[model samples]
Target chain A: MLELQDISVIFHPGTIHEKVALSHINFRIEEGDFITIIGSNGAGKSTLFQTISGAIAPYQGHIFLHQQDITSLKEHKRSRFIGRLFQDPLKGTAPSMTIAENLALAGCQGHYFSLKPILAKQRQQMYEALKELNLGLEERMDTKVGVLSGGQRQALSLLMATYAKPQLLLLDEHTAALDPQTASKVLELTDKIVKKNQMTTLMITHNMQDALTYGQKIMIMKEGQIIDVINSERKKDLTVEQLIHLYSSKTNDYNDRILL
Target chain B: MLNQVVVIGALELGSIFAIMSLGLYISYKVLNLPDLTVDGSFTLGCAVSAVMTLSGHPVIGLILAFISGLLAGVVTGVLTTKLKIASLLAGILTMTGLYSVNLKIMNDSPHISLFDCSTVFTPLSVFGEYGVLLFIGVVVIVVTLCLHYFLKTQFGLALRACGDNEDMVKASSIDVDIMKMIGLSLANGLVSLSGAIYAQHQAFSDSQSGTGMMVIGLASIIIGMAFIKKDQMAYQLLAVIVGSIIYRGILTIALQIGIPSTDLKLLSAILVVVALILTKVKMRRKEVC
Candidate 1:
């Protein structure tokens, strides 16, 4: 379980250009809950992810994971349990490293100081994992990831993030860079991995249909505040049109790009 | 224009410098850091080796030199990572500070001679004419093999990845700062070790001996990498060794052509610039086609 209490983030604080990125944001996420977040541009979606992942410290708030306060933890230290993926596919994996080597890095995350080589057993495990993706990446385990397509890289990035079965996963527009077909493919893979691991995930998406179709709940954010959260029961019968109507009715800000 | 002895001497010098090139391989190639501390740490190694050799502990001198080099590297690493200084400026600052530190290590003397003192290679002198070369060759090979295996380890993978993609490494729960520190420290350590050996081999240690050492290392890497064009660790390291020898050969040829010894540093700088320009032009040509 994770909880954010009175979280507020002010960018460029004390300056004339100061803006409240996130204001008094509070939420409690249950174990294994898949929550899809929807918002227009500058709705503090990515900023919320950064605050949760310790990438950006909150101006005022407290965060608790498994009932322990983790607000002051460093980003790398918090990464032991929290897996995060960026919007840019290129930001998530080492381009110069081979697929096998990248997987080895993910597997040996906390034990990074070990002098042991990537053993044969570990290589076999990575091979089987990649085979399950059915992308034929297993055959190219030694290939440098630089030449991989955006969708392929995102799929690989998802695999690396969840390889250790992190307790909390944050996806900040992971598939926004891919073509429609590739984005949907990577999204499907993400859904499968998150379901298989029963991981607690918070995914931000601009596509209204995706937010409606996936996840157990839909969270609507406006002006850095949670306006509404439709539960699993309500989310089952929610339509994209109805969700968009609910968003516009509460925030009065409508954008055609979110329909995509 | 070259004698057999001069060729052999060049090979020996190449092998000794190859150890230093291996350090540069880690910093410049693997870590992608243009660490200018090489000039300072190289002399630090020489100073420590000289002082230790004069005290009748030649082998211990080499170990101390490597350790001192590691410390110098750590200073640069701290400045870059902890203090948020630019990497280039950090290296320059550390190099400048190490000048006084290096002299202090030498009891404020700018030069020291080991004419009567024994060195790590002294014991191997029994093998006669080829003894020094053989000893240096073994040392280079051992250092190369150690680095090769180290980079293959899981920890080494993290370090390499830290250079390749810092964000990925941090997200993977690896400390990028610590990795950079380790890379810088090891690079300087090996470079210092090379200086220690050079001092003993040449029978003298001079504070000015480290000038333009960074360019020399870069020249070796550039020349060697152009040949292999492969990403494998074994091949890459082999390229560095070959590059060092080739670089030394180029200098030998320059000397043979009647270039004064005093102008060797200028020649090295010119060679590096030419090599870099050639690489850029070749890359542009490839892109055009």
Candidate 2:
């Protein structure tokens, strides 16, 4: 299980322009539990993910992975345990690299980059993985990733993320860039891969439908604080309207927050 | 007439520039930054190598040249990454700083001469006739190939990712600062290593020799990448080597045709501009078609 204890983050802290991006964020995610996070603009959803991924350390709080305190670990050290996919398709994968190279890189988990050629069996394994994407990417393994369309790139990014099965996967609006069809395809692929790996994941999505459909748990955030948490049992009876009602009731009663 | 000796000279010259170009490629293409420090660092390589060779250690000179360049590159990286300076300005700052550092390393002078020393290639005369070029060519090829293979490895992937997207690389658990440090240092190291060889080949290490070297390296990279099929790493490296030769070959041809030596700079700029335009054109075509 992953846990965040009283996580608080302040931007431009102690200055006149100080803004609390997150305040005393406390949450828990169990292993193999897929969670979807929903929040409007400036709701601290992105900030929460950034903090969790070790991109931005919390000013106050302790983060633990499987009961091991990971708050002090550096970003790369954290990466050994967590995998992330960004909203921008171009952000996750190297554009200049070929599909095969990208896969090879993922296969290596970005380690030993200066030694060892991609072995034949590894190459075949990567090819087989790409083949499941069913985009004919297996045939275009040698093609540069820059030449790919947004959907294709996002799919490739998904593959790269899952290739090195980390304990926790972070999807930061990963399908936000593609067309509806492509996004649906990528989401399908995501569902398949996430299930196949049985990986614990925290996925943040702006689409209300998406949040309702995926992940065993759903979270709503207003300020830095999580307002509601719905588990699989409770979420089964929940609808988009009920989710919005739950989010609004808690946020409206809070008084200080001007929800976006 | 393409005289055999001149052809060999062009190849040898190209090989040296190829090393510099590959180094520059890492900084520019991968890091996505304009690194002016390569100019001073190139000379640093030469001065260190020349001084070392003069003191009777050619291998030490070569190794030292690489290390010196690598250190200089790291300084540039530090200036940008840790200090949060703009990339171009950081490079310029380091480049200016290297001017003095090079002088100090060379004992308060901006130049050194390895007039009668055993450089890595200096003792290669025993090969009889095509000795120097052959030996340097082999060294260049082997080193380039090794780097090429290295880039295909996992560490190299992380390094490339650092250049392409620092945020993503950082998210993946690689320190962006550390990767940038390696990129800058390694890039300049290659350039300086070539400079060291150039110093020993011509038997002089002058500060002026480094002037416009960054531009020359960029020009070589642009020319190489233009012809190199994008996405083909091994061939891309080979193209850089070939591009350096072609670039040098053009200079030689221009000289043979009696073009005034003073016009070389203007010509280089024109060549780079043309290549840049072509790159845009190709990219745009990809969008349209």
Model 1, A104-167: lDDT tens digits are 9999868988899889999999999999888999999999999999889999999999998999
User: Which 10-residue window in model 1 chain A sums to the lowest lDDT?
Assistant: A251-260
**Residue B224 C-alpha lDDT in model 1:** 91
lDDT of 2 at A260: 16
Give the poorly placed runs of model 2, Cα more than 4 Å off.
A252-260, B1-8, B109-129, B259-263, B281-289
Question: Model 2 over residues B152-221: C-alpha lDDT tens digits?
Answer: 7777877777777666676676778888888898998998898888888878788767878888888888
Q: Which stretches of candidate 1 lie over 4 Å from their true place?
A: none
* Candidate 2 lDDT, A71-178, residue by residue in tens: 988878888778899889988788877788777767665464357777889889988999999999999888889889999998998998888898899998898888
The CA lDDT at A30 in model 2 is 81
